[model samples]
Target: MDYDDAYANVPHIPDGESYPPRWAAEAAAFREARATDRNDLGVSYGDTPRQAYDLFRPETAPKGTLVFVHGGYWLRFDRSYWSHLATGALARGWSVAMPSYDLCPDVRIAGITTQVARAIQNIAESEPGPLTLAGHSAGGHLVSRMIQPGLLPIDVTDRITTITPISPVSDLRPLLHTAMNAQFQLTEDTATAESPALMTERLDIPTHIWVGADERPVFLDQARWQADAWSCPLRIDKGRHHFDIIDALKDPVSPLMRDILG
Candidate 1:
């Protein structure tokens, strides 16, 4: 389906619920599991302690590392609830890392992105090996920011073999016109400067862009746009929405997850 068709399928945001119920439940379960296994590390971003990340690894074996950045439209969510995302990768011998950063409005999107970059650098320093990076929603945007050529310090960027940004906000211009402005407070210039779509940048590592069949039209459009610009793989998960699509990652064998990890 085209981006428009994919977008028209998105469910309307209800008055009280921001994210879907299943996603909230899954995030809650992931956080609960992390309470026992969480390992916190402090990473510095300009002498402040606000930047840090949590590492979750399988007890017996590991094949590679997958670093996930949680998304809340650049405003909400954190690394804690995201440890559950490691489940599928752990079963497949991949360790998982999730980083927390200050939200936007309080901190500009640019600052938040930079902090995430520092988080990746710190994680890679401690665990050196083949790595795959993935992010969802705004986190997906952060992943793109993390891998932007010449942006990352050498050591971390060199280790990434593949990147998968699921339902990323590659373009921020449209968001400025939407209700998301409540938190993003995106100026046209800031949106344009921050968007990967307008940046004309590419990563040497293989990149895959995936969007749910039922994601917001803007999101699907941006995902496809990124794929077209970068000549990367573009995938649409059938019968899925923005939130449900990432749930498939909980199962390593999932077609979406396989494309991501491969």
Candidate 2:
């Protein structure tokens, strides 16, 4: 089925290789420009080095907290590459937390899921008010997993107001045939267990599935699978591909931000 090519995003997007460096540079500049008090860097959520998260606070009292998880197919990228994404939420008076979890090959997808859960629990402890979660790609899968029963503490789950999984991999069974599965080491059992689309019950949290209209057909299908499974609203952002779809997170007034923050 050429699952690898089906899931591949970079080659399909024009000049996609350039996006990472640009994201890193922009994120660095954002960190440098932000007030020291507003940005809390390298806050530990777990013992491992990559287990920490970057917490960005707003100028006035926060209305709530939004935790954003980055997607590198569970292989590449970290919290640093996404610090700038917090701008929109911060501007809207919401504290934003971006966490970096250990990637695949170093740990299984399930382990990465556990790390994110701990990171969210850690963030919720200090940040009060309602909570909203948003994740991209592999991260979208992780955030969706959070709504599963008993995955997070009851208190934390109760505070969750909404979740938006952008271009999420709702079903993992397709990846079993991919070459990357060698690194992922996902068994049929594990793949089904990790698939958010397979769940019949959720935590009653409001969920919205988002995907780029211009994304590869598989991604669009994955998004639709999730929306159908959860019976939730799905939004297709016109003219956006996978890489650029997340750019709206930088704008407070953008539909994505308004949907998540409001």
Candidate 3:
């Protein structure tokens, strides 16, 4: 199989190149409208400049905290492009935290995983209550890794109520065959080691795998592989593709929100 093409998303999605700019505009508007009162921007979670997170709080006291991780295959984008996605969870009275991590070729995927864990730990320390996580694509893989034994503190893991990995890349072995592997630098050992689907045990938290019905077939397979491996539920949103499947996250009452917030 042509692994590079199989994993590629832009060429398949119509006008996919337009999404980043649109997301940037929407996120900028969201930040301006929400303001600094409830929206805390550029809060440092680590020493590095990229290791900051944006926190969006609701009107009333939050019932819990939801951490949403953005995806760019661990290469591109940042927390700034995804502030609007916090709308649904905030409308449901949950605080949302989005973190930016150092991308690949600058830092390895494993390093990125550790950074996400630290970001979540930082959020949990200040936010309180149950923790719900939702991540997209590469972010999905990161959230799934958090459930692996010893990856996170027991206190933090115990507070995690649920996790939803949307269009996650569960297995890294196949990625070694893709052109992007040059940036990933994964060996046979590291690929298997980083694969959440290859894990023998996880934190026992409730997990739900989500994929778009119209997404590339490999993503569907990846989601299924995680669901099966973790013995969790899986949802395929109808009429949605990889690029647009996460759009429902802006709707407070959308099924995707219900799945994440429930």
Candidate 4:
């Protein structure tokens, strides 16, 4: 789809009361259960002035760490609401960390990506080995930043084994022309530099790309371009929308989950 067609299908939620209904419901369920089975609880890993991430480790676990970053187009959402995702990975003995960063305008995408690297470094320094990074939507875009050879701090890159970004906005230029630009404040130059598609020459790690079949054409296009550029394996979750595709991680057998976990 062209840029116009892709933007039209992009989902936009107003500032207040803007969360997706499915996320609200799932978050509610997780919150209610938190009081009881808090074994898989969350922890803050970084104390940076403007950035923080919550770590969720499984009790008596057996796998590597999997950091799940939340997405709000680099301007919305929090670590609290996304802790539930850790349950899926934790159940399989994988530790999960979700970091919160200063949104756009207040801090540009470059700054946000930097914070994400720090958050990962904070976790890796304390808990070592076979780390895999994953994120949804904007969060997915941020994780891609870490995969770039020189984009992330040296220490953080050495520990990561693989990366799986689900429904990521790997290419930032597309957002510059879409309604998302109003909040993202992306310039053509910034978009090109921040975009993973343009940064392909820098990708050095094995990465997996996945997107929902029902996502907006723009998102699908972005995913396609990202997969093509990286020459990485691309998995499509049939019938899942952009918002719901990430939820598949909650199910162990989900196509999205399997692609990343395996």
Alpha-carbon runs more than 4 Å astray in model 2: none
lDDT tens readout by residue for model 3, 1-262: 9999999999999999999999999999999998589988998999899999999999999999999999999999999999999999989999999999999999999999999999999999998899999999999999999998887889999999999999999999999999899999999999998899999877788888899999999999999998988889999999999989989899999988888988
- Global lDDT of each candidate: 0.75, 0.94, 0.93, 0.75
Rank candidates by TM-score, best first.
Answer: 2, 3, 4, 1
Q: What are the TM-scores, per candidate, against the unseen true structure?
A: 0.85, 0.99, 0.98, 0.86
Root-mean-square deviation (CA) per prediction: 3.9, 0.7, 0.8, 3.4
Pairs in steric clash, model 2? none
**True-vs-predicted CA distance for residue 8, candidate 3, Å:** 0.6
Q: Which lDDT value does model 2 have at 127? A: 91
Best-matching candidate per lDDT: 2
- The Cα error of candidate 3 at residue 104, in Å, is 0.6
Which has the higher TM-score value, candidate number 1 or candidate number 2? 2
| Residue pairs in collision within model 1 | 63-93
* Better candidate by TM-score, 1 or 4: 4
lDDT of 1 by residue, 1-262 (tens): 4433433323443332645455557666765665454444343433554577767776656677898888877777666556667778877877788788888678889988888887777778777677888999888898887667777877677789888999888888776656657677889998988887677665688888888786676777889887887788889888777776777778978876687677
